[model samples]
Target: MEYVIKGYEPADALRYFEEISAIPRGSKNEQAVAQYVYDFAKDLGLEARIDTTYWNVVVKKPASPGCEDKPAVMIQGHLDMVCEKNAGTAHDFEKDPLDLYIEDGLLKARGTTLGADNGQAVAYMMALLARNDLVHPPLECVFTSMEEIGLLGALQVDTSDLHSKYMLNVDCGPEGTVFVSCAGGLLQDISKKVRWEKAGGDTVSLQVRGLLGGHSAAMIDHEMGNSIKVMGRILHGIQKQMEVHIVSLSGGSKMNAIPRESDAVITVPAGQGDKAIEIASHIAATAKAELAASDGGLYLQCEKAGATERQMSLADSRQIIEFIFLVKNGVYTMSMEMPGLVVCSSNLGVATTDDTGVQLTDFIRSSDPTIRDHLDDEIRSLAQLLDIEIAPADPMPGWKYEAESPLRQLFMKLYKEQTGKEMVAVATHGGLECGILKDKMPDLDIIAFGPTADGAHTPDESLDLASFERTWNLILATLKALAEQ
Candidate 1:
């Protein structure tokens, strides 16, 4: 593959960035990229292994000639990326390489995510491990898979080979702010069983589209319009004025991404399809206004559909739509400890209605354990009331900011000295693998930071080219500072 990122300061970093970007490393399909990491280390004559169960790659580069005695430091990042694209984009995540492009000094993938959320970590770590000029302690790079869905790889991977008590996590999206703590989260799949029945009516397809859906945890406070909820609201409202029976309902691709669009095919009373659509338009108008600031491009499109013999009974359809509209979603609590930080939230991420039933997926996030428990209880109660089948699950614990983190202090010191700006330590509502890794490796000191990237977990995701190289320099400087210790 030809590299579009020429002239970057560290030639190897840009080269590896372009190389890995071509591998198609969507969550759970990281085999090829994991192998690439292993082979890269093997070719360098370093210790490398891929965990058989989850395909997590771990490689060790020994300390520089003079820094052999320094403590082993692990640089960690996930190998998988959240594959998202615009609705009309023709790119396929299963096999097609990302089409990289540059605009205004920012690197982006045409109509698809750039994969820089953690891919840059891969490039940066690979460059560091491959270079002999950089001074650093023994380095362990843990490339875990399936981080985009959940921290499954980090949770399942064997870390016994790693002896590092301290780590630099390269997964944050900001440049100067170092993430010290992150919210815990629970992923749930909920279902409501149903039976189809014959309905005599005109069919119409109602689609909620053009909403700027984003990462559920990061942008929950933005109040972005969730197409699922918007469609539910339209259906719920339409039913108030006329009889409606749903044929099929579906929306969203990833359970962690707020849905940008949803489609519902339904039967309106014979000769009353026009009225139902009018009501849907009225309801959608309110939603569009409410969503103008964050998800302004919201659209509710309706069209005639071919004949369908069966549809869900109005009782089943109403229950499904009402539940979606009334579900616990968006931010629930704010942090008194950290101003402007959301402490607890949930996203109603996906919904599908088919021959068997309606299934919905949601993610609940919180930094406080008690709040997480309370929210879980609320979901359980809601599901029980509706007779919905939601399997019981445990909440993954959040990472708490430690008072004594030398790694955080080191980065802050180096960042201030290098850039003359304070590198603030912060907590986030977003979930990170650090929580799982820190929970498993109890004594592992960790801090996460990265280059400036935006619209993460969405097709609009972009990496600042200059900021990417700047952060790479910071990582190298920190490595040098640590080697001198």
Candidate 2:
């Protein structure tokens, strides 16, 4: 394959990034990428182990001559990327290679996500491990899979053999910020059975689209519109004036991402179809005006559709609509200690309705355990009220902030000296493997930082090339400093 990145310092990093981009590594399907990392380690004669059960790889390289006695440090990142694309893109993530291109000093994929979130981290580690010139202590490079789904690989991987006192998680977003703490989260799956009845009316399809949905945990406070909730509101408003039965309802794909588009098929009284369309149009206009600043492209369209044989019963339809509108979403609570940071939040991410029932999946996040418990209770209470079954899965622990860390101070001091500016230390609402790894290794001191990447978990994702080089330099400098210690 021809190289796409040219005239860049540390060309090997970009090369490896592009190479990895060719493989299909979305969430649970990470065998090829994990094997690539394992093979690379073996080719370099490094000590490596690949856990096929969880698809995690751990590679260790001995310290340099002068730094052999220095304490070992681990660098970690996930191997999977969130597979998102534009509505009309023809790319298949399972088989097609990413069409990467350079634009205005940033790297992006054509009509799809660039997968740079953790790919760059993997590239950086690979580059460092292949080179013997860098002065650093014994290095442990760890890569886990299925992180986008719920940090499954990290949760299942065994860390008993490794002994790294300090860890650098290379899965964060912003270039100049070091994340010391992150929110713990879990997936809540709610389902309710429904009975269908024969339909006797004209059909209309209602759609809510063009909303700028984002990562539910990071952008919850941004007030971006949730399409599932918005569609429920519009349906409820139409139901107020006319009797409509739901034929089908579906929206959103991933639980971690906010729903951007939703559509529903409903049956209305043959003669009252015009009135229902009018009501839907009015609600769409109002919603557009309300979310203009955050989701400027918000649009709602209602159109005539062919009649369906069966529709949800009026009672079941009403129950589903009411439950959707009542479900809690967006920022639930703000942190008292950290101003402007969301302490607790939940996203009504994936929704679908079928003959058997309606199912809704949500990803709830909280930095405080008590707040997490409260949010769980709130969801359970709502489920009980609606007579739906709710199940929580893969609950992960949160990483608490440490006030005094010599490693953090070292990175801060090094960053100041290199850039002549201070790097910000922050607590993020997004889930990170650092929390799980810390729990597994209680004495591990960890910090997460990465190059600037915008529009993560979306089709518009891009990586800043210059920022990537600078972050690479910072990591090299930090490793060198640790060796000197």
Candidate 3:
């Protein structure tokens, strides 16, 4: 009987992709999906290894015919998705499978992110395992957990027992390009505690929203408005004309996603309350005119709310506000070789004020390891300047491309013979398993390829129905070429 499951067809990868859509596998919570892979592999009679602590699964397929002596190849892709949603979208990623639908030739989520970033690749590998007729050398397929949160699972992988000397990672964007290298990144947290004070009169909240936020490294150059920056501009504008005491400030949802909105609560003297609104209006007008093409929907509003007149001390508030203004929050430079590619960047991802202290999170990325470290140092200097505690978390290393890779040459020849066109090979500015896997298996030849996926790490994540078939055909053709060799 032909498999008609949501995401399990041998000919169409979408079949397997549909099955992934029904599973809840957001970052750090990958137990269910990990078990699914284990069960799926066992049912197919493949040798499966499951790691309980890390929730990693690996499946091995024996070599075919005369290829038994060939070196084993590893196929790797992450199992977790970045859980992000639109404001007011009410789907829980922990329990609810992503709601997937098609519109105008693009697959999209219902006001949330479609987990296609790595899900499609996972499904594709699973489908390959179910096939009985395909011929190739021995294979090892690895599914890692919590890659979105960090390369935690990959880091925890017990590589001592692995048998692969070469790997092909399927967790990258753009089908036509073969990503041979990528950038490294680091996450930093800056925090400060300030004394609270009581206000004499009325208190209100100011909010900025509707900005087009995106992946800080990928979309930073677009010049789309930033919610945190917009809020800072308004707050500074208000401070110019009147005396306002900040009660609290909060915005952003994740340490990775660009913050699309922010809110601040402050006590506005009844005398200058009207003036505060006037200044906000002026900021909004300027933003509308400036962001008319990109952040046209940007909004700034002041609303009355019931609150204690208690607020942070004046000195504390001033220092925190100044820090936000001084911090770097966008594309730092462009690649000299790859005109449009971002060589270095950073994002002031999130910030919030609480009873103890104000916590802020920033993420930085760069293709050069030295530059990534430099950026982290710059942020640490900011914390020192403001007398705040700072923490820099794990840094993911970049994949360095090999100019003399035999596998790359093989792929290039295969594509030219199959399509009569030259293949596009380049390095990406985003993180991929290629970097970590390379670190684990230094001599392992690696290359990353996938179907056409646009607007990844966002609500518009989707796979081209037509591209899936073509890409799968290419994968199969490549396998045939390798078998002949």
Candidate 4:
């Protein structure tokens, strides 16, 4: 199919989107895109500023003909995207254009994320900058980097440069719903260093793979499989029935993603080793039966182990399994006011074992401050019980919903006028830039909404074609309404 840009409005949008697709703006690696924005603004004769601390780029567009005196409004979105790919897929984020292509009426990348999570919104902002027809107040377009890793960019942004009393963040995943609140989160670290000894026997390596892993925060309550938890159960079962020495264990790629696969090395006496293999197969069968409907391809494979060194002592092995089982891995509570909303949750995101000890990382989330604190207390308690060192971190706060938020009302009215249907206002289970930006501009009016996308932060992530036009209309209408006010 041939792509065309007949008008300047969408022409600018399409151009910017295509340009960045080739720039490789993965998280914390958005310097090229940031510089692109800066140079674009300067080339267009607009005053642009770059904040070195947070690496936030802003373009100040002077008010148009009749709107120069109107109150300024800021439109923001992140520039970086989470870089992830499927196993066996040959792709390099450091030097690739994402292999962009249109399929089944949706925009996506080949075997990888399209980065439309925030890229589309950034493209829209860039388009607006190139056009002079957009209505209302003086405008500022801000693009922040390192948003995927954390709210690092927003956390370090110089709010003193902000001249707007009201702000609109175009980072929500769904198309029609307006998100005004999101969950607060923190990263927890737990580690233990214990001695280990070798047990004479036949060594075997176990591999568990093919489970559909997803975002820890968004998919935690789904009861989906977790590699660390599954492998721990197997190890515990084997140790209970026979003596086994754990040589090594590893799982998970990122702290924010649930582990989908794991591998472990253990040694068992030749005679008892056959029994261990049978037990592993049985466990796999049971797990497959229980997870059949959701995780069909889950696998557990055992291969004869080559010569291996010593394994952890019984004491160390027991303590490790106990810690893994004791730590929470899913939702702890549901929202009382909002049905199906996770109020508190935890994820055992990563695990690794070595001669000294094991290191674990857990990601905790909650909309209620008290609940989050209690969960932290539980994590600390577990460390004490296991006699291991525990460390916790303080993260950004959640954006609490405001019942009478004026910005939300305006968004609703505009949404209805554009579509002739009621618009839903919701609080997301995921993170948003609103919470961090609101901290700097305490009274800043904030609302987040974006084009429709599914399987975000995963390989299946894709953007809906229809939502592109709908959301663009809603956004344009909202901008006009703000200007008229």
Candidate 5:
């Protein structure tokens, strides 16, 4: 395939990014990318180790010239991307390469995610290691897997060989903004046994689509429509007027992404089909108006569906619908200290009703440990009240902000000198691997910053070329300053 990235500064970084983009590295599937990094390190005669079990790669390069006394710096990023695409885009994330294209000075993937989130970070580390002229201390390039799925690789990777007191996490957003803290998060699954019986009635398919879904933790404050909740409302409204039984229902794919589309098959009384459509249309219109500013493309439709042999019992159907409607979603609260940052939030990421039961998965996030515990309790209490079985996954620790950090202070100073503007140091609502790594390496000073990117964890994700060049320069300058210390 022909490369689409050209005429960009830091040409080596851009070229490596394109090469990384060609590999399929979705969460839990990072073998190929990890191997690629390992091979690159081996080819350069650098000491490297690859842990296939966790899909992590660690490479060490000696300090340049007189900078041997400087503390070793660890550069970290994940090897995976959240595999997301538009409704009808026929691209296989496991085998096929991403179809990358350039648009309006930004790098994007056609009808799919561009994987620039951590891919660019990998490219930066690779380019830096490949160079021989840059004056810097000993470098340890660490790449972990499954960051999008709760930072699993970071939590499990063996870092005993690493000897870095200062770490640079290149997995942040908005160029020039340094992140010192981020929310901790966990995954939860709720389910209930559902019985099905033969149905003899008209079937209708209800669908909710076109909402601008995004990263649950990062964009929950945007007030975008959640398709699962929207579908629940429409279903509840229809059930209030007529009797119906669900045949099958499914929505969303990943626990980290807000569902953009959902559909359900239901059998209603022969004469009540018209009423169901009318109710769905009314609800869609109301939702559109309410979410016009955030999700203007919101659409809901109901049409006659083919006959089905099995349908969920009315009791089970009603219970599922009520559960979805009652579940807490979106921004639960804002931080008192940070003003605009989201302090507590949850995303009803996935829902499916099948032969055995109705299953739902959610990702809950909170910067405060107390709030995180409270949210977990709230979910359990709700499940118990509804008589549903629930299972909560192990939670990752949140990175707390420290007012005094030599690394952050140095980065801020360098950023100001290079750009003539003070870099904003703020906490993020999203979960980052830095939090997990910090917990393991308590004495390490960490800072995360990256180039500007939009629509992450979604098919519309894009990276700004201009911001990429600028951020690259900043990283080089920071490394030089660190070595001088």
Candidate 6:
């Protein structure tokens, strides 16, 4: 395959990135990518291996020529990418590779997510392991799978074999910022059963689309429109004015993405289809006005569809709508200590309804466990009222801000010396594997940084070419400094 990215230092990083991008590596489908990494390590004559359960890969390279006595260092990243694409994209996350391209100095994938979120980390690690001239300590490049799906793979890895105390997580913000902390999060799966009845009425289909959906955790504070929530409002609004029965309602592909589109099909009393459409259009107009600042492209389209035989009982439909309204979503609270920092939030990522019932995938995050629990309690109460089952997974622990981090300080000093700007330490609301790894290796000192990227977890994802190289150079320099210490 022809590479779109060129003239980048550590050219191996971009070359390996292009090669890996050609493999299908959607979350839970990372076996092939893991094998690729293992193969690359084996070819380099490095001690590389893969596991059966989670497909986590580890490649070990001995210390640089003069740094054998220095403490070993671990650089980690996830192997999976969030598989999201535009509606018309002909890509397959399980079999087809990403179509990489270059646009206006940024690297992009046509109609699909660029996968640079974690790919950069993988490529950089590969490049470093393959480079013999670079001054560095013993290298341990750990690639875990299924990180996009609740850190499943990272949670499963056995850290007992690792010898590194200083770990660099390559999954944070752009070059200058070294991430010190991140919020903890959990997924709450809500399901409710519904009874279907024969439909004998006119059909109206409503689609809410074109919203600027993104990473639910990182972009929740942006207040972008959530399609599932939008559809819920539209459904409720139609019911307020006229009797209706829901035929189907669904949207969203990933449990961690702000759904870009939502769709609903319902049946109304014969001859009342026009009224339903009119009410829906009015509600859409109001929603558009509300979303203009963040989701300017949001629009709702309503049309008549061929009649269906079965529809959900009004009781079930009402229960689902009420549950959606009761659920707490978006940025719940901001930190008082840190200005403009979102301390707590939840996202209604996906909503789907079928003949059996409706299942809603929602996630919550908070730096404070107490606040997270409080929000969970609210959702638990809603589930109880609706007599629905809400299964909450064990929460991912938050990376707490430490008063003293030698690795962080080192990076800060090196960043200041390398560039004239002060390196800022920050926390992401998005869940990083750092928290999970810290839980396993309590004493592991961790810091995270990456190249500039935009629209992560969405199809519009792009990587900043300039920041990409700057970050690579900084990481190389940081590694050299650590070896010297």
Root-mean-square deviation of every model: 5.5, 5.0, 5.2, 4.7, 5.5, 5.5
Q: What is the TM-score of each candidate against the true structure?
A: 0.74, 0.77, 0.77, 0.79, 0.74, 0.73
Error of 5 at 11 (Å): 12
Model 5 C-alpha lDDT versus the unseen true structure? 0.87
> Residue by residue across 1-485, what tens digits does model 4's lDDT show?
22332344454565676678778888878888888888988999998988765568989888767878777888999999888889977989888877777678787888888888789878888887888777867888889889888878877777787778778898885877888678888788788877867556888789888889898887888777888888887877787788767788888877878899988888877777778988887887788778888766788988777867677776676777777767887888887666677877888888888657788888887766688788888888888888777775776766766677777898898888877888787777677778777767878788888889887788778888678768877777777777777
Scored against the true structure, residue 96 in model 1 reaches a CA lDDT of: 95
Candidate 3 yields a Cα-based lDDT of 0.78
For candidate 3, write residues 30-70 as lDDT tens digits. 99899988998999899999999989999998776777877
Q: C-alpha displacement of 67 in model 4, angstroms?
A: 6.5
Global lDDT of each candidate: 0.87, 0.88, 0.78, 0.80, 0.87, 0.87
Q: Write the per-residue lDDT of candidate 6 for residues 442-480, one digit (tens) a residue.
A: 788899988889998999999997788888888899899
TM-score of 2: 0.77
In candidate 5 the C-alpha lDDT for residue 144 amounts to 91
Determine which window of 10 residues in candidate 3 has minimal summed lDDT.
Answer: 1-10
Residue 52, candidate 2: alpha-carbon lDDT: 86
**After aligning candidate 4 to the native by TM-score, how far in Å is the CA of 481 from where it should be?**
2.4
Q: In every candidate, how many clashes are there?
A: 0, 0, 4, 0, 0, 0
lDDT of 5 by residue, 303-375 (tens): 9877888988888888887778788888887877666989889999998876797899988887777887888
Tens digit per residue, CA lDDT, model 2, 38-150: 99999999999999888999999999898988889999999999999999999999988898999999999999999998898999999889888889999999999999887
Candidate 6: where are CA atoms >4 Å away? 1-49, 60-72, 78-139, 146-152, 183-185, 198-212, 234-247, 260-285, 296-311, 366-370, 392-403, 451-473, 483-485
